[model samples]
Target: MTSISQTTRPAYSAASPRSDGLSTGFYKLLFMTPTILVLALVVAGPLLYSFWLSLHEYIITYGMGDLVWFENYAVMMSDEFAGVSWVTMKLTVIVVVLEFLIAFGLALLLNQSWLKFREIYLLVLMLPILMTPVAVALMFRLMFNPNLGIINWLLSLVGIPQQGWFGDPDLALATVVFVDIWNETSLMLIMLYAGLKSLPQDPVEAARIDGASAFQILWHVTLPMLKPVILVTLLIRMITALKSYDLIYMLTQGGPGKVTETISFYAYRLGFRFLDIGQAAAVSFILLAAVVVLTVVLLRIMREN
Candidate 1:
């Protein structure tokens, strides 16, 4: 019997099996296939198509005309479109900053200890966001009609001179910016209020117990913690503001000497009015690049913080 067991077989190393590794990888790919397909169809497909179109002088009516290479981009970088881009950039910055400040203040007010009828306040805030953007623009158009609008009527009651709201070249952009802020600040407020409510209360209470003033607690403790939420909100609002078109179109139609012509509105005019599809595509790509850069920078800053 001892002699028979002399030739023992080598032990099997189950941990080092290639088949197991391959099977694990296969399962992961299988699980991720649906997500990959969806992204390819919804995002990657359109993005690739747009990029391909950007490379060629493609017109909607005439079809593909010429392989213009970077001509479209070069044209967009020229003096004519540069002004539109600059105006858009200015509006984006102003609207985002003002909206964030106003929304944050509203959030703080709503979150106050003695605030009453929270639901009613929130509902009133939500009304603007809930209204159709086109309808909101039309409503503002009527209100800002320099001649016989309600805004001018109210100004008359106070014995102030009625001035052009959307008629004057200098005033049109500001009027639209004000309307945009009014319409969207509620969404930002809601987001911030939720963030405030969900925040851990113990730290705030601890700060208060240490005789920290409300401002000190907010500045030193609460705000630092709320930074992530605020950054996210800012990024979202910035993107929305950058793409603002419907309201601008409905209110001013890029009028008052094109003072309120945002990049989006400009792109629309190029594509629809002028039928310059290639130029419109180039403008869109530029806007896309700006948004991507801004999103990446904000994300990096948030991560660093």
Candidate 2:
């Protein structure tokens, strides 16, 4: 009886092994192939191509030539490029900080129960974000025109002197930064508002019952609890600010003596204007490195929190 049972069990298992094995293998491949293909196309392919370009001295007219190794990277690390990098960093920091402050305030205001027409206000705030960046830039450029612009006209009524919005070298960067903050603050507001809405209400109610002022509750309880959301908003804003180019380009074209040129604009000039593909590729990689470092630091902070 034992021998017969063993023989029967072995036959049953053997009959199914090959078919089940084949089916499992097929299912695994079906699920994995698309992911593998997407990674190859989106990540690996461009990375390899950029690395190859970085190794060579590539010019639009002359095409790819003898490999130059690190020459392009060396040039990018020179004083001029270093200055551009500094300016980009400054712009990124200023925009992110200002945007966060404004967005947080707006979110708090919008979340208040006494506010009227909240939906309309939110829709208006989101309109700038939805509008084409180029169009928005142009609109701001028109409004801020030193002469024959409504902004200057209003300033005249208040007896304030007209200042260049995009024309002045010193003011161009600041103006563009303001535009960026205005355009993106609504996004941060939306994110923070969502975070506020999802927050557990029991703590807030307890704080109120304990005679906590609104400011005290916000400072001690709400903001602390919203740290993750704030960090996420900051991360998004920083990355976006770092890559800001379209609005600046449309508004000032990095003009008034390159005062508004961010790393993205610098890369564009290298690749398109100067036709230095290798140097452009190097600059792009450098920008990517900065972004990667920031992202890693942000993620680490989030994990710790």
Candidate 3:
């Protein structure tokens, strides 16, 4: 009778502890709780707070003013903000395109097996990327100075007129654009180089055997294979370029008549310097929205391509 009763019992209930699943689930929640809390505290909370602040006219001296919903956003969409937005976009595009072109060329050159001491060359080239943005910007600032600059000195050696790089409003933004290209090209090069090295040789060999020209092979085979890497590289560079502040601040401080004033620096000026916290927060959220929109557009294009 006892044996019969034991055989009739459910297998899972007889074998396993009831608390096993519950305990495992509890432990998982416990481990993940800290991360959840930190993310809420740092990211979500602040974003919400900024939005709340943006809806009100909160100045530093006077506390939170009347809830003037969307007034700040309205002001931000004016012609003044539009000009800054255009400048920011222009800088991003110019810097990203130049970096891509230069980096792509360098990547191809480095990928060649005939190059001697290639590792040393790569290491030397990578030195710029190792430095902090502020430090790099400061270094370039000295080099771009018209009077004491090595750049002007070199120009003078070649009998060319010494150009005012950062001092001239026309050249100031473009100079820093070039500065960004120089500083960030190495990252693109490394990423593309790794992608090139990792590509399967079969398709390339087959293309060659089929008598495809070098350009044809690169255009059809290598580039198609490298699409993912290229997309990733473009995405990263665009985001970095969009939020460019440290280098700009260090080099020109958005001087020479506010021609180089990007939206990030403009926002900082609006809030911290001018003490219009509400409007500054509004500008920030607008910038954030713009970034998100651009990123989404980029992602969509990449996916479609």
Candidate No. with top TM-score: 3
User: What lDDT tens digits, residue by residue, belong to model 2 across residues 1-305?
Assistant: 98989877753452345544655456668899999999999999999899899889999899999898988899675876887888898888888888889888988888887899999998888777787888888888889989978998998899999998899888888888888887877788889989988888889899999999999999999999999988988997788788778887898777788777778888889999999999999998889998898899788877887
Write one digit per residue (lDDT tens) for candidate 3, span 1-305. Answer: 97887777654343344545454446668899999999999999999999999999988788789999999999675887987888888888988999999998888889876999999989988888888999899889899889998999998988999889998988898899888987888998888899899999999999999999989999999999999889888888888888879987888877787878889988888888888989989998888987898789788877886
Which stretches of model 2 miss by more than 4 angstroms?
1-25, 301-305
What TM-score does structure 1 among the candidates reach?
A: 0.84
Could you tally the backbone clashes for each prediction? 0, 0, 0
TM per candidate: 0.84, 0.87, 0.89
Q: Name the TM-score of candidate 3.
A: 0.89
lDDT, residue 296, model 3: 92
Quick one: best lDDT, which candidate? 3
- lDDT by residue for model 1 (123-196), tens: 89878888889998888888878787899989899998888988888888899889998888888888899988
Model 1 residue 106 CA deviation in Å: 1.1
Model 1 misplacement above 4 A: 1-42, 301-305
